[model samples]
Each structure stands twice: as structure tokens, then as C-alpha cells.
Target: MARTEFPAKATHAQTRAHNASLVLRALYDLGPISRAAIARLTGLTRTSVGELVAELEQDGLAQEVGRGPSTGGKAPTLVSLIDDARHMVTLDLGERTFTAALLNLRGEIQRRATRNLDGADGDAAVALVHDLIDELLAGPHSPILGIGVGTPGIVDSEGTIRWAVNLSWTDLPLGKRLAAHYNLPTVVANDSRAAAFATFLFEGEDRPTNLIAIKVGHGIGAGLVLDGQLFDGDGFGAGEIGHIVIEPDGAPCHCGRFGCLETVASVPAILRRAFFQAAESGVRIPQSIEAIAAAAAAGDELALGVVRAAGRALGMAVASLTGALDVRRIVVLGSATVLGEPWFEAIRDEARRRTLATLARDTEVVNGGPADDAVLLGTCALLLTRELGLTVRR
Candidate 1:
């Protein structure tokens, strides 16, 4: 057995911050209500809730909206979150392009910009990030909250990038450099983990406390949110499942391993399979994933076969993750998800067949489809937690 070190005892300041967060969370979820209602919902004393709300008002985070109907006497006053009080600069460093967005406190993008990296690397790649930020900062936005970045790689707690093969970056102190240069708070995290937090924070009131969100595109990765917090393994690679050697004798991975999960289940893998099929049949190769999905939907046997093969590969990985973590909510999102129903069915079937009947029967695996702005929103969630000591409940 190993020794387990518990967290340090929280100080009075920590307690106050936690209670204040509870109050803010209540307003975020069920806003425009009375201070009394927030106190009741959070189980905090009215005095504490009132003081916190006053502080928030002074900070321009909460404001009086209107009045609510009274239960028996005079109507009660309502307080609401100032969703646009602060703006967050968010970035999603994608495989081929880096996208930057200015979003309000509610995670709604106000302005957007993108830069085509086009194989930029090293210092050039880092410069592109600064360029995008400079454009956003020059635009029209009020008090800024700092910068939030979601990129591809194994990121440590302090935002050091261990490796990102395509970007040709290794052990990059990205967070520290950005913070020092920009003179604003900065948060950097693995894109997959960022997407996982976005999914969790936006999942509404009845959502589960734990989830596994798998992003499959040019590469494949899964982020584990356990007990409402990200669980980065001791090596800070907990979600690097894409490189797991699922096929000991399969094709070589960029990570120098053979038959890794990415070689079989990622978008690149599916496209490669499609190209082979098209070549064998003397048909034009799919120009994009949508083309393959279209052909499969039209009952093209070859296209369906290729799609199913990739789905089954992903399902195997999902089964392994579900068994190890026992997290029942699994969400699949990314470019490959465009394969839609046929692809999703194969994933679901293979996962159920491989996992225990009792576990599989109750498990719910859903397709989230497309990456969209998930990474951008997730990094913002991290920034909010770090800067305001509040979680993004909505």
C-alpha cells in the first residue's frame, strides 16, 4: 500500500472564499433572485450571503435586477450576475490554426480571430499566439480577466508543455512566458482536458459529477473529470490515451510506438482507411470526413466498413477507460464524430460487448459531435476558477 497525503487544512480566508464561491454559484445557476434565496440554496447564513453579495456588487460582478413576487408580504428584491462585467481572452491552439476569442464572463464570444499556423513551429509558433492576443487586446472590451489557452500536449500544473510532436515543442514553459510578457494572469492546459471541463460546466443541473470526454480528430485523447475535478496522473499524462499501444503490431505512431490507438481510431486513421478503400475500388478518395460519412449514409458498403472499423477501435479504448475509472458518463466529440449514426452504433456495440454486463447496462455513451468552441470555453472555466475562486456552473 502507498501513503496518501491529504490536503492541508484550509485557513479562515480559504473558508471565506469557498463560501463566497457557493454564493456566486447560486447566482450563476439560479440568478435574479433574493439574497435570502441564495442563502437558503447554499445553506449559508443570511449574514454571510449578504456580505458576499455586497462584495460582489462592489466588484461589479452582481447587481440588482428587479423584484420578485412576495410569498405573503412585500415583494423581495432580486440580484443577478453581471455576465459582461469582465472579459476573458481565450485561445484554442488547433492543429493547423490558432483561434482567439474575446468572451464575456458568461463564456459568450464577443469577437473572434484565427491565424493559420501552416506548419509554424518553435519561436514562430509562440509568436503567433502573441500576435492573436495583441489583436484582441486592442479591440473594444472592458475590464479584462486575463488569458486562457487550450493547446495540444501534456501540460503540467504550472503550464509547462512536455511535448507536442506536430508543433515541435518540448518542455516549453508556455504559461510562465505568456504571463511575464503579457502582464496578465494566464492558464494553459491540454485541449482535451479543457474540452472535458467545458462539457462538465455546461451540462446543466442534473448532469453527473464525473465524466470522461474523448476528443477524436487528427489525434485522439480523453480527459477524465473525476469527483468534479480533473485527475492529472502523477506524470501529467492521465488523458494521453491516444498513444496507448492497443495494437502491438499495428502501424507506427508519431510517438514511436506501433499500433497505438491513434493509428486505428483517430481522424487520420479513418481517412487513411478510406483512401485505401477508394484506391482498391478505383473510386475517388474521400476529400474530407463529411464525404466518407455521406457515402456511408448512402449505404456504400466500403465506406461503412471503413467507418465501422474505426468506431470499433475507439470503442475498445472507451471500454478500457470505463472499466478503470468506473465513470458512467462518456461523451465523444471531435471531427471524427461526423461519421454519425453508423460510426456511433459500432462504438456503442463494441463497448457494451467488451465491458461487464452490469456495468455496460447502466453506462450511457453519447456522441457530442464536432469540436466547435469547447476548448476555448474550458480554458475560460479554468481561468475563472483560478482568478475568482468560482466555478462556472452554467
Candidate 2:
């Protein structure tokens, strides 16, 4: 028997929508540009561009900026996107707090609000999210376009949080719940994946579409963007690297494992080691990542040694990524990045030592230095693409 197949087709509306998005993209990337320039760039008919521009103007998304210099004829009027035509609400659910913000179309923060979770679990934590959103919405803003959420743990593409140990959530339909209660478009994604997308979108132009962003806070995970698209893997665990065992005989992890990357490379790991070292040296234990960073900055040999060890652990993961994926761009984010230059040097050194000479030579391991709002902006990016068919440009 022959294999069954179905023919694919696009309806007239679908074609028009796709073309409209193309026109918008051209205007966003190259405007203040003339209609003729947009037509030339997008390969759409001049008539079609005119109609689309008029529609966009009527919808308050695009407007004429000014006239361009004459090209041996009459000067052309330029049009540009109304960067604030729409607003999106974004949230980042962190270990100790939940932060929310109002953002413009360009992913610029308009206003922000936060609430401390304080180890709140179950219903209380969920309510805290609602409280933050309500507070932001109650501010001087109306007609919100949608909502975006960045959280920890496994998140299905359908926006279900399969499991978040810290948040006390399991198989929670957070996306659906938010959308229904607020009656707005909602998107949810893992924090690392969202950070990866944010790095890919905002890292400037003429760059490769593939990049990896590793979030090393209390946990360590990575997000991969391949060919300008987020690859969630078959099980939605594409970037779940924190739990991978690096030292099988080392200390036990909370996930019931021994010597996982999270046990050595994460912020908690560094702090734990710092405390132990302090106990041995009869020195006061540093209480936070910031304090340890400050100590390292003051040339504390003990603190620097602990940071170097953690950085080396992280570099092992980088070597794995470079050797396997050969992705040249690796961005490290979260509070752990505050360990500063010494930590970064150790990471780069180990990654180069472990990977192929040529691959390591071309790889650029960038420290993003605690992009606190990356999750919010990344979910906003995801929302703009999935809901509005638009790419965010700064």
C-alpha cells in the first residue's frame, strides 16, 4: 500500500497575512523608509504596499515620518513603526520573588512591579502572580495586547508547566488559566529558553541564528536557538543540563543525584562551597552570591578559589556544547555571572582546553552579567512571534 499524505495549501487570508507580516518586518528593520523602498525590499507590488501601509496607518501601527531626498524625481514620504502602538505584560517567576512589567512593542520596559514569594507555595504563589499582574495593569495603562510568563522547570509548548519543584506546580495549565481569567493572549516558557531567545533577538544584526544561553542561578540549564527558531527538543527538555552528573562520586544533589552540574556550577553550589571554606578557615561565611563576588573583588584568595572551581565546572558543560553542537556563541546569565572576571577566565580556559582547538578558537563565551529581566523580555519576544507574527527589533 502507498503511504497516505495530505496536500498543504494556504488560503487567500493566510497569504495576505503572511505578506502583511513581511511588509511590517521590512518597515521595522529599515524604516524610516519610503513605500517604494519597502516594495523593492519585500518584492510586493507598489499597489499592495500602498494598501498595506494605509491599513497599518489606520490601525495606528505605522505612520509617515518625513520625506526622503529625491531620486531624480519627487521626494518620497517615509513611514515607520509606532513603537508603542501596543503593550505586553511579562512576568518572571524567580525563586524568591515574581516580577512583572509592561513593555512596548520594541520590548522596552514601560513600568515594572514585583512581589516576594518568600517560599510561598501552591495557591499562595499562584495568587501572588495574579497580584503582580493586577497591580501592573492597574497602573496608567490600558488595552494590554497580551501576557507573557517566564518560569523554571519543564514547560510544554502548549504552555503547561509539567513540573516546577520550587514553585510547587506540576502539570499546571498556567497559560490556559491566565488566558481564561484575564481574557487575553498568554504565553509561558522555561526561563532558560526564554533567556536564550532574548539573547538571540537582541544581540545585534549580521550574526548567526544559532546560539546557546545558559542560566546558572540556583539551578543550571541552557536554551538553544537553532536557525532563528527555538528548539524545545522532542521531550521539551532540550536545555535541561543542570541535573547532568559531572562528578559521579561528588556531593549529592537535591534531585537525588550525586555530582550534578547544579551541585557545582550553580550559584547555590558556589555559596555552599563558600560556607564550607569559611567554616574551615574560621572566617565568617558569606551569606549571598553578591557578598562572595564582593569578596572575590577584594582579592580574597579563598573566595577566588571557590569561584574558579565553579567556573571550571561550568566550562566542562561549555566544552560539551561546543564539541557536540559547535555553536560559537555561548551566553551565561543569572546571578552567578556576578562572580566576575576570574570566574569567566576559568570558564573560557577550560572550554578551550576540552574542545577542539579550531572550535574553541572561534567560540565566543559572553558573560551577560545577570540579565534580571531577560525572562520577561524573552517571554514577550515569544508572545510577539507566536501571537502577532512579528520579530522584536531595538
How would you encode candidate 1's per-residue C-alpha lDDT over 1-394 as one tens digit per residue? 9898655665667789899888888887788989999988989999999999999999999999889999998888999999998999999999889999999878889999999999899989999999999999999997888899999989998999999887889999999999999888999999999999999888898889899999999888889999999889998898898998888999989888899999998988888989988999999889889999999999999999999999999899989998887889999998888899999999999999999998998888898879689999999999988987667756
Pairs in steric clash, model 1: none
Model-by-model lDDT, in order? 0.91, 0.90
- The residue-level lDDT of candidate 2 at 384 comes to 86
Candidate 2, superposed: residue stretches over 4 Å from native: 1-10
Task: Compute each candidate's TM-score over C-alphas.
Answer: 0.91, 0.93
Candidate 1 RMSD computed on C-alpha atoms after optimal superposition onto the true structure? 3.7
For model 2, how does the per-residue alpha-carbon lDDT over 1-394 read when each residue is reduced to its tens digit? 9996644454667778888988888877788999999999989999999999999899888999989999999999999988888889999998888999999888999999999888898889889989989988888874678999998989998889998877889899999999999999999999999989998888887657789999989888899999989989998989898988999998998778899999998887899999999999999999999999999999999999999999999999999988989899999998898889989999999999999999999999999879898899999999889876888865
What global local distance difference test value does model 2 have?
Answer: 0.90
